[model samples]
Structures are given as C-alpha cells and as structure tokens.
Target chain A: MKSTLLLGTRKGLVVYRHQNGQWAMQDVHFPGVPVSIAYADERNGVWWACLDHGHWGVKLHRSADRGANWEEVTAPAYPEGAEIKPGEPAHTRYLWAMQQGGRRHPDRLWVGTEPGGLFRSDDGGREFQLVESLWNHPSRENNWFGGGRDHAGIHSVVVDPRDENHVYVGVSCAGVFESVDAGKTWAVRNKGLRADFLPDPEAEVGHDPHLLVASPANPDVMWQQNHCGIFRSVDGGRLWTDISEKDGPASFGFAIAVADDDPDQAWVAPAVSDMHRLAIDRSLCVCRTDDGGKSWKTLRHGLPQGHSFDIVYRHALACSGDGLAFGTTTGNLFFSADRGERWQVINNYLPMVHSVLFVE
Target chain B: MPSVNFTYALKRFFPDLREIDLKAESLSDLLAQLEKKHPGLRAYVLDEQGRLRRHVNIFIDGELIADRDALTDPFRPDSEIYIMQALSGG
Candidate 1:
C-alpha cells in the first residue's frame, strides 16, 4: 500500500513512486518554479509548496524533512493597512489552492489566492493570516471576474469531513463559498449555478466554478465543474443540482474526482467548450459517474481515442487508492487502476501539469 | 557609492548575488540596501505595490530607469547598478 504522486508542474514538484506495480520518477521538488500548488501533509509529515515566481511574487515553501529540506514561508500577504482602491494595487497573484486542516484544525492551513484571497495557517504550514471575513466581503466589487489573473481566484478548498467547522470555496469568476465559523464568515454558495456571461444567468455571485469536489464518502456531498455546466450539491452547499445534462451534450471540464468510498463515485475530464479548450472530437474521454449524476460513461478503454489535444487542469484530476491520476496540457501522464476503466501512460516527458495529488 | 549588478537571469533565484559595494543614495536606497543583504531580494525586485516589477529592470550607469513608480533613481558614486530581468523585448 504505497501509492504516492505529487505533481504540480509547469516545471517543478514531481514525485511519483507506486512501488512494484510500476510508476517511477522519485524526486524533483520545485526545481525550476511555477508549482501553483502542492501539498503532502499525509496527516502531519508536512510539505506544502506553492511557488509561482513568474517575475517574482507568490511564494510559500515548507518541508519538514519528508521533502528533505526547504524553507521560505510567509506567503499570502496583504496586511499592513490592506485596503486598496485609490488607484488600486495589492498583490498575491498566484497560489491557486492548498487545503489541509481538518480533524479540528491540526495546525490549520488553508490558502487560496490569485486576486481572491483566503489565507489561514495556524503554525503547521508556518505562518499565514488574511482571512478577513472572506476578505471583507461586501459582494467584492460587483461579484468578481478575472477567470485566472487580474481578479477572482480561489480555486476550490473544500474542507468538511463532517464539519471541521465546515468550509468550502471555489471561484474563478466567483461562485461557491461557505464558511461555518471556521473562517469567521462567508456565504454565497451559488444556488443552482450558471452565468452565461451574466445579466442574470442565475447570478448570485458571478458563477464560474471550473471544478470543485467533495464526497470523500460524503462530506455532505458536493460536485461542480462549472462556467455553465455540471453541478450537484446535496445540501452542504445549500442547493445546486444540474449534473451538466448527466455529462454530455458538451459539458466542458477542468477536472473533478470523488469516491473515497463512493458517495456515488465521479470523475470528469471532458472538455471542448469554454471556447474549445480541446479534446472532444479530437477524442479523449473520461467522464464517469456511478448512478449519482444519473448516468454518464465514456471512459474510452485506456483513453485517447484519436487526434487528441489534451487539456486538464483544476489540480489535474486525482482520486486516490483504487485508482485515478491525471496530468496533461500536453505533458501527458495518466494512470487508472480501473475505477477509471483501464489506463496507464504514467509519464510522457514531465512538465506542464499543474497539480495532481494522491499520497497514500 | 554605487555598484550593485545582479542579473545572470537572477542566478536561479538570487544565488548569493554579486557585485555589491553600495553606499546608496536613492533607487530606493539601493533597494533598501538590497533588502538588507538579500533575504528575498525585496520580493525579487519590488512588487506588492512597491512597484518596479513588471519583469524588473533597474539600470543606472547605462541609463534605463524612468522611475518605475517611485524608485527615484539617482545613485552615482562609481555608479553601475544593472539588475535587469526583461528576458525578451516586446
């Protein structure tokens, strides 16, 4: 039972090592930069690395031995006077997500930023602060936007293994947010979801959740992959239900995986929307749902069925143990011990994959 | 008294950095004395509202320094400085 894989790349963090059954490449941590997210807190062994030094900004590294050695901490900034607007200019432009603080906060650590912020760390990941009632909330300047750069950016940080004070976040155009006393306060869970460019496409908070998963057996059940499609929220998120037409009719994708014990199981890798991000006719499948989304199959025996122009992000898929691992933007690397219906590419060159974890 | 240097593509991420020798007289006091001797190199050369970080640039003896937002250039005393990181022109 030795399964480990942590790849957050553009060029760094890589460590795959699934013993005797195959998978190799052992180490390579933050070697060149761009690792937008990487956490390996196997409960407490600690190792969180989120660096995105493109011209320098956003850094946070910490490794208490497991990763051999590393330091640099104080990342999520914006404090001293932090108010902005009078020309506007604050920072934190990267760290898309990193969550590991449950069982009643074992030294908490929850970061998610870009333009959207939410920091928190109680000493385990070293030092972090900025939670500021969901960063001052006040409907954050007309609901938030910038899909990945200039504004909205909280790339999914769901924690609620049955209420560790419960918490959830997911934004990329802003939608899905919750906090049950743990983060001081926050609300707006985007009811049924949708924002066909807004103007009231169910707008409650801009809507654009790209990918968000829960159901590690059932953390009150949640699942989303939106921008205008796939959604499900069984109550923990207040309300939501529109399984993207049960995974077809062009549902788009940015990755999502569940099934830590099957809250009905799930997975998605579709794509061919959001203005053709690729794969779908260029053929590359991976949409599976186990009676939960009502129906969806398309796994494609070992995957990649044609021309292929891969694209998968949103922490690059990932469901551990009995199998599922993903990475691609073209750097390839696949694995599936069956739950994804046969697959195994493992590594093609190793680069451009931003986030994929499974450390068991 | 100025010397400064730093730009071999930022030695991976400031590997000790080089050409130092600063007495400082602006350019934000040699970047606050190069971040009091390089701890994060003033966030790789200014940002988080302190400005100067579009891709970074800080020449002096060879010219380039139009005050990328309050850097206030002016250090001449054997003046050199450099610091660059453009990587490619537009």
Candidate 2:
C-alpha cells in the first residue's frame, strides 16, 4: 500500500504520511508557490514538482532523496520558430502531465505542456526536446482549441507498460491521440467520443477528456471522466463506450480512478453539471462501479451531506491498493480505506487542490 | 560597466543572487552576460522567445524600458539596471 499522499495545491505541495494506522501531515514543500503537479516516479524514487509561478513563468524541480533536497531543472521550451498560430509564437504556458518511460528505458521522461506540445527528456529530466511530430499534426491548427484555458493543453500521458514505444495522450478540445512508434507517428482515437459543444457532436477531434486512466491488471481497459460523461474503452483506446449513469449524480465529474487488480472496478467523484460545478444536491459523494460502469453505487458515508461546495479536479483523485484519496476545490481532502465504502477527512484548511497522488 | 539588480522574490530560487556589474551596450547583450553569471536567471526575466516576460519589468536608470519584444532598449556605461516583478495579485 502507498503510505504517502502528495497533494498539489494552489499554495504548496502538502505531504501526508500514514503510520501506526494514522495519517499525519508530514512535510510541506515550496510553501506559498502553486504546485500544479506533485509526482513521484516509483521506478527511480525520483520526485518531481511542476511549479506554475505567477511572475516567473513555469518551472520544474526534482528531488532524489524525497523532499529533503531538490534541484531545479530546465523546463521544456518551444523551439524558436514554433508558433501557436501564424502570428502567435508558442511558449510553454503550463506543465500539465509528466510520466516516466517503460522499465527498459530508465532515463526517458515525457512531459506534456500547454500550447499542445509534448516534450521528451532522455537524460532524466535535465533537458528536454519537443516532440514535433504531434505538434505539427494537421488537425491541431484548426481543430484543437482550449477547454478551460486560453490554449489547448495535454493533461494525460499513458505509456503502455507492455511496450514502451506505444503511448497515448489526452488533449483538451483535441481528443485522444495514440502513438505506436515512440511518438514518431500519431492517429486519432476518438471514434465514439461526443463533444456536445462542437457542431458535429461525434467529430473526430475536439473532445474534452478531463482525466484518463488505464487499469493496471488489464491495460486494454481504459476509463476517462469526460466533459460529456464517463466513458470506457475495452480495446485500448481504439473505440470508446459511454458509461455514465442515466439521470444520476455520476453524470458529470472531473476525477476518475481504476482499481489495480480489477478492470471492472473504478471510482469517480460526482458533481453537478458543468454550469453548476458543485456537489450534487449540495451533498458530496463518490460513485463506484464494480461491474464496468453497468451500475454505480454512491458512497457518501463520512462525507458532508448539505451546504457543501466542493468539486474535485481532474488529477485530484487517486487510488492505490485499497486506499482512495481526493482533494476538493474548496481545500477539503478525503481518504477512504475500504475502497469507497467509507471516507475520513484528512485536511480541511489547505489551499485549493490541483492534484493528489499516492506515492510509496 | 552597468550594474544590474534583481527583485528579492527571485532569491527564493537563486539564493546567492546579488548585484552584478558587466560591460554591455544593449539590454539584450547585458541579459546574455547575466545568464552566463547566473544560469537560468534569463528564463525568469525573458521567455522562450527571448521576449521579456509579461509580468516582469526591466528599468534602466529608474525608467522602464521602451522595447519589450525586440529588446532594442539601450543602456549607457555605469547605468543602474533594475529587474523586478510587476505588481499583480488579487
């Protein structure tokens, strides 16, 4: 079981450690700075902190021995001639996603950034180069737009555990893209996705996937909490199936987590529709699907029932073993021990949580 | 020689940051020299396109620079250059 929870909040990275059957606040890093992503690379025990500095721009930092020491690394940069459009020059506005390569490629790291650029670092994150193949895709110029931000961004990068060369990235307003040859070539995989905002609801591109996760036991089974609803892909990402609950609280949300051993089991934090963006009916609940979204069970025990305005971000919910944790926009953090059966408050006065990850 | 000073907020990242004097003719050239002295400082002041960051301000002798995109602003010898973060917050 992962015993440490890293909460990337607007103010800093708050860490909590579980010991003696109790979770306690362990340490805080980069206090007063907004940590967009707090990630721990389990392969090499290297921890990464992606900082969204208001005045200094985006920055990256890494720590080898946990949070005791950290070293700043060069953040990914768009090339000199790169442009978001004909006249708008492109720069890395935000670092949204970070993932390590397969075990075979130990030093390889992938970083997804705003302006829709995917960067790769071969030297363990000391330097990075833009993956131009995906950036120069034909659909990006006209089809890729922003969802919640001013420009398109890549927020999820899933590296195939079986083959390092195969990768998938989820882009806001651009849909899912698959690369079979180590990001040298790409193909659209939004066959069954629906974008209600577009003229064509089932367009090949322009789908908003809030978060994407693959089942550890069966990587072929992928799940995403999308703007439209919840979706599941049984055959990798070649095709998707809508799995959202019919006229239920699970219809809209941002975060999703799949069980490690069961592809049919997953969890999602439920909120109102996009317009409201609040807990359903002024009550907080987490919906669990044990049979691959065919049915859902609402878990609300130990949660606020009324007068709550908490909403979870895309990366704020995570699952490890039997442990489930999520942080809310209103600075409320909850943890569950028996899957989603019960929840306990971890913290209530932290800053707005951007991401939450369970690290070893 | 022109001496350049930085905002104290940057000291959080660059703890040893201090005033430095270098011989340069233009703001762009002076920034390149400053990058050599302190690595990664130029990125805080200028973006990937070499343009001054939107929220960063550079003043020559207490006057804000005129050119931000091309960085054609000039500075004289023995001039005092101040690089600061713009006032922005809720």
Candidate 3:
C-alpha cells in the first residue's frame, strides 16, 4: 500500500504520510488556495497540483523533487477564436481531470477542463495543446450541457494500459467518449446510460457520469457512479448495465473505486439522491460489491452514524491494494486498511477535500 | 512612458513584482511590455482571448478601462496604470 496521501482541499494541498504505523501531517503546499486536483504521476515521481483561483482563473504547478520545491507551468489554454457558444469565448475555467500517457509515451500528458475541452502535452506538461477532434465533435454544441457546473466538464480520463492510443474521457452531461487513434478521432459510447434530466432519457450524448474508473487487472470492465445510479460495463464501455441497489442506499452517490486486482470488486460512497445531497439517513456509509455489483453490503464500522451530513466528492474516494481512503465535503477524511470493512478517521478539520490520491 | 503597478496579491505568485514604467501605445501594448518584464504575469491578468479577466481590473488614472475585450483604452505618457484584483467576497 502507498504510504503517502495527497489531498486537494478547498484551502490548499495537504499531504499526509504514514510512518511506523501512524499517519502524520507532512506538508502543506499552496497554502490558502483551492487545489481542485492533487495528482502524482507514479511513472516519473512527479507531483502536480491544479489550482482554481477565484480571482485569477485556473493554474497548474509541478514538483519533480517531491514537495520540496515547485515550478509553475503553462496551464492548458483554449485557442484563439474558440467559443463555448456562438458569442461566448472559450477559456479554461477549471482543470478537473488529468492522466499521464501510458508507459509507451513518457512525455505525454492529458488534461480535461471545464467548458468541455481536452488538452494534450507531448513534453511532460511543459506546454499543452487542445485536442481539437473532441472539441469540434458534432454533439458538443447542442447535446452537452452542465450537470453540477454551469458548463460541461470532463472529470475522468481512462487510458488503456494495454494501448496508450486507446483513450476514454467521461464528461458531465455528455456521457462517455472513446478514442481509438490516441485522440485523433472520437465516438460516443453511451448506449445504455439514462439521462433522466433530459427530454429523452436515453439520449446518446447527454448522460452524466460523475466519475468513471476501470479495473486495473481487467481494463475492459469499467464502472461509473453516474448521476442516475451506479453502472457497470463488462466490454470496455460499449454497453452498460445499471447495478444500483433497488431498495438500498447504494442507489445515488458521486465516488466509486474498483479494486486494482479484481474487476468484480468495487466500492461506492452512498448519499441521498439528487434532491438531497446528504448522507443517506443522515449517516455515512460505504457500500461494497465483491461479486460484480449483483449485491451490495453497506459498511458502517468506524464511520459516522446518525445526524451526519458528510458526502464524498467524485474524486475524493480512492483505493490502493488493501488501503482505501475518502475525504468528505464537510472536512472529514477516513481511511480503511482492510478494504471497506472498517475505517479510521485521519482528520476532521480539513478544508472540504476535493481530491484524495495515494502515492508511494 | 506610463508607470505600471500591480496588486500585492500578485506578489504571491510573482515575488519579484514591483512598479515599473514602460513605453507603450495602448492598454494592449502596455500589457505586452509588462509580459516581457515579468514572464507569465499577463495570464494572471488576462484570459486566453486577450480579454481582461472577469475579476481583474485595470484602471487608468483611477478610472476603469472601458474596453476590456480589445484593451484599446488609452493612457497618457505619464499616466499611472493600476492593475488590481476585484474584491469579490470569499
């Protein structure tokens, strides 16, 4: 299991290190800044922090030597003459998702942003260029709308470890899109997703997938915590099946994590539906499915029970080996060493954790 | 040459920030000159489309510039250009 946890919070990038059977606060970067995403590129041991400045727009920073020092790099920018709508110009409002290009391309980096744009960097994030193929797709203009944000945003990027050329991005209010030729061309893959908010629930490109993840051992098995419910795809997202609990708290949530070694095993943080974004029954719990979502077991050991309003964000929940961790909107961080059987509170005064990442 | 000033908030990112006088024609030209002096400073003040950032303001002699999109606001040779961040409540 990874020993370090990098937390992107509303206040700053908080890092905690587990040493000698105890976790301690190590360092804080970008003090008093809203770090939307805290990512560690395990391939090259580089740490990245995506900042969402309320007054100065979005920014990106990278640190090669752990957290000792950092260097500001050019954040992805929309090209000139680009527009979100006919009259509204397109600029990078937020950096929601980031992934390193697989082992084949050491210098490649991918970044997904709000207002619906994808960017690629060929030189290890020194500079980034917008991927025009997906941006200029036919359905982006009319079909893609906002879910949680005012404009559509890409929040998930899954790169097939088998082939770096095969890329997948999950967009809010736009469903899933796949690229076979390394982002040169794209196609929608929302065959079974249901967008209940749309006029047509089965629309091809307007589904909201809050977070998408594929099992590391079996790349073909993809799972998403969607706006409607939990969905699973057995054949690389070509088709999806709703596996949400019919009469349980596992029906609605934002974050989901699949075991790296088991495609059939996954966990989800359950909350009340869209109408009420609070902990189900005012109690916090994580639901686990070890048999491919056929059934779910709510794990409440060592978690808050009764009168709790904590709900995890889409990017806050993560799992590595036998360790699992998640941060809540109400500034609580919990970790479990034995899957989701039991959890321990790591902190209680964090500043609305945005993303929680485990790094070796 | 008009003297250019920046908000102290920017000093957090660009620690070397200081008052400087530069020779330029318009607000756009002045910004370009400022960019040369302080790398990556223009992006903090302007968006990708070269428009003034929504929360950032550039005032020429205590008055807000009228042309935010084109940045065509004019200033005298000895004018004091104040680049400030708007006080939107946190």
Candidate 4:
C-alpha cells in the first residue's frame, strides 16, 4: 500500500509521497497562505484547507482531485446587519479547525473558528451555518478568551465513530464541550478536568485542552493532553481522570495519538513546562502508554538524544495504520512503525509543521 | 478611466492584477469593478459591511483616501490608485 502525508504549515500545505521505501516532497499547496489545518477526506476524495490570511480573515478552499486543483468555498460568515449582543464577537477572526462527520454521515461537516464559534455544514463542504447554540452560550464570554490571540479558538474536533450525532469539540482555554443532538445544544463536559490557573482548579469550562482524541477501538474512551496535565475519560467525556503522574517530566506537550485497534495504547511528546516549553533537557522523547495511561515508557531509539528543542503542536501527531508519526516546530518529522517503540526521521527539514496527517 | 495598481506583495494572491486601467469615479466604485474582474479580491480589501479592512490601505494618486467609511473620495479620470497592505503585519 502507498502512503501520502499531508503537512499543514505556517506558510502553506506540503504534501509528501512515500514509495519504494523513500519519502519525497510531492507538492506544495497554497504557497503563501498560512494553513491552520489541512484535511484529506479519503473516503470522499475531497480535501479541505483552512487558510488564515491574517489581514483578510480565514477562508476555506476545496480541492476535488486531491491537491491538484482548488476553488474557494463560501466561507462561514456571520449574517449582515446582525445585532451585536454584548458578548458575541463583532466579526469572525480565523477558522482554526475542521472535521468531517462520521462514516455513517459523510455529508455533514463541523468547523471551529477563533473568537470561539462552531459552524456546521450539511452539503458537503460548500456552505456552512453558524452553530448559534454553542456560539451564544453564556459561558463563552468568561471561559473562552485566553489561549488564542485576543480570543479563544477551537483546535480539536472529534466525531464519535459509533454514533453519528454524538460529537466532541475542544476549545483552547475554555475546555471540552459535547453536543449530543448534532450540535443543536451543548453542555460543558469538563467534570474532572482542572484549571490550575484559575482560583477554582475544578471549574467546569475554563480549562485549556491542547488536544483530544477518541480511541477507534472504543469511542467511549478518550485521551487528552491539556495545559495543566494529561487526562483520560472512559465514559464519553462525562468525567476525566488526571494521568500525568505517570507521564514523566512535565507532561506538557501538545500532540497525542492513540492506536486504532488497541484502546489501551497511546503516544505523547513530553516537554518542559512553565517558562521553557521545549523538549526536556533539550532531548526528544516520545512517551507511550500501553495500559491506558496507567504507565508510560519513553521512546528514544533512533530519535534525537541531545540539544532537541522541538515543540510538537496538536494535530501534528497522528496514528496512521500501525505507525505513529508527528512533526515538530523545528521542522523535523519522525515516524514509528511498532507503536512508537522505535522511530526514524522521515523528513529533517520543512516549514513549521502545523499538522501532519497520513492518508492510506 | 483611472489607472489602478497593487503593491507587489499582493501578487501572490492576485497574479494578474499588477496594473489595470478602469473607469470609476470613486474608490468604492473601483473596488466593486475590481471584484467583478477578480473574485474574492473585495473581501480581502473590505469587510462584510463594505468598510475598508483594517489592514488594507488605499491611496488616490499620492494621498491617502480620507473617507474610509463610504469611500466617497473622488478621483480624476486619469488618477492613479494605489492599494497596499497595511504596515502592521510586516
């Protein structure tokens, strides 16, 4: 089988092809546009790129034939002449994340944006309507403002594989939220999460979740790498249990990956917390948990052992097939085939990688 | 007909829009006509309410436009309009 990797970067989206046991850069899409996220829906043969022009706001583009050609879609926009409630944002800032619906519902798409809003699309990826229920929730003003530039952002969108309507979203600085009825209404799902920065560490909605992923083998079981600590939930995000005690160092990196067939397995890159946010001791180590975060082993074989200052971002680490791959802020890529027990550098240098996704 | 030109920085997004001569009496009119020729260009320069984007600047001839709200600043038929990104992002 052939594998293609899509990397969203600070400058653009880079595509690499792996064949004959070698990897090479295949294409660069949206050369000068800052891509916050790049997603390839292999099931539908469609690609979506979230471009943040900064001066022009964020827009969505669609490519029908992989990444060969592209056309801009009707971007999610707030209606004209809308009355501004005191708390609602005056205008959209940036489109931070996007995730297509489950296998049973291919036509549905969920989008997250800065200023912390959710938008849903029913017609593939052409048009979108704002999820007003989540946007207008009263807690947004107080909870969603710290992680992003000037406002909060939704960086993780996970759709439950077992149920089409059950969805999950992670907001930076605002914690995790779940929508049981297809995004019509939402509730704060941070029961056992912690926000140590706040006066109350157990607040319901102000915690910062860096990344969240559901186990393919068991959708009810999920893992999260948060600003404060690493957490796990077994009952569909109703409650969380901090598991960072076993995760050595500070347990403070941004990326997390889980095995497809083994819900008890997961991978994370640990970094120094507090003022310095780089790899611990300038050494790169990826921690793997075989007993579902109960215990973790640091994987360093074939990886950098000295002077490593890599800060992996959320969405950069992905579990592809039987392999685990992730990129770093220093523009290096690593891949492991035996569940992160060992690693090899696939690409040493590229633009700052925002996302690294594997398409089989 | 007024002469319109964009800074080299915008060439990445608008490849064929380095220079053009068009008939327009005001900046707003020129932007509308420009959008008709190159789709999605207006949204980058103007907001949803048609106000000039905060990070975009327009100068009529050698002077900056005074009316950003309605863009009613009149220009001569042969005036040269210059559009460039605001210096903030740089």
Listed for every candidate in order, the interface RMSD values in angstroms are 6.2, 0.6, 0.6, 2.0
Pick the DockQ winner: 3
TM-score of 2: 0.98
Estimate every model's Cα lDDT from 0 to 1.
0.80, 0.92, 0.94, 0.82
Candidate 4 CAPRI assessment class: medium
Fraction of true contacts retained by every candidate, in order, equals: 0.61, 0.70, 0.73, 0.39
Give per-model TM-scores. Answer: 0.38, 0.98, 0.99, 0.92
Candidate 3, residues A1-360, lDDT tens digits: the string is 899999999999999999997789999999999999999998999999999998888999999999899999999999999998899999999999999999899999999999899999999999999999999999999988888899999999999999999999999979999999999999999988888888899988999999999999999999999999999999999999999999898978999999988999999999998998999888999999999999999999999999789999999999999999999999999999999999899999999999999999
Per-residue lDDT of model 4, residues A94-194, tens digit only: 77778888778778898887767788898997788888888788788666775735678788888987787999999987888998899988878899998
lDDT of 2: 0.92
Clashing pairs in 1: none
Query: Residue A78 in candidate 2 has what lDDT?
Result: 97
What is every candidate's C-alpha DockQ against the true complex, given to 2 decimals?
0.23, 0.82, 0.84, 0.49
In model 4, what are the clashing residue pairs, if there are any?
Answer: none
Candidate 2 interface CA RMSD, Å: 0.6
Residue-level lDDT tens digits of model 2 in A60-160: 99999989998999999999979999989999999999999879889899998998999998889999999999999999999999987899999999998
Kindly list the per-residue Cα lDDT of model 1 for residues A1-360, writing each as its tens digit. 238888889778888888889989999987877797888876777778898877767788888786888888778777755643435676787889888878567888888887788888887766788898887888876677788467888888888877777788998887888888888988898987778988899978888888788898778889887867778887777898887654364277888788788877788888888886888888777888887788888787777777889888878888875789889888898998978888989887877898888875
- Name the candidate that leads on TM-score: 3
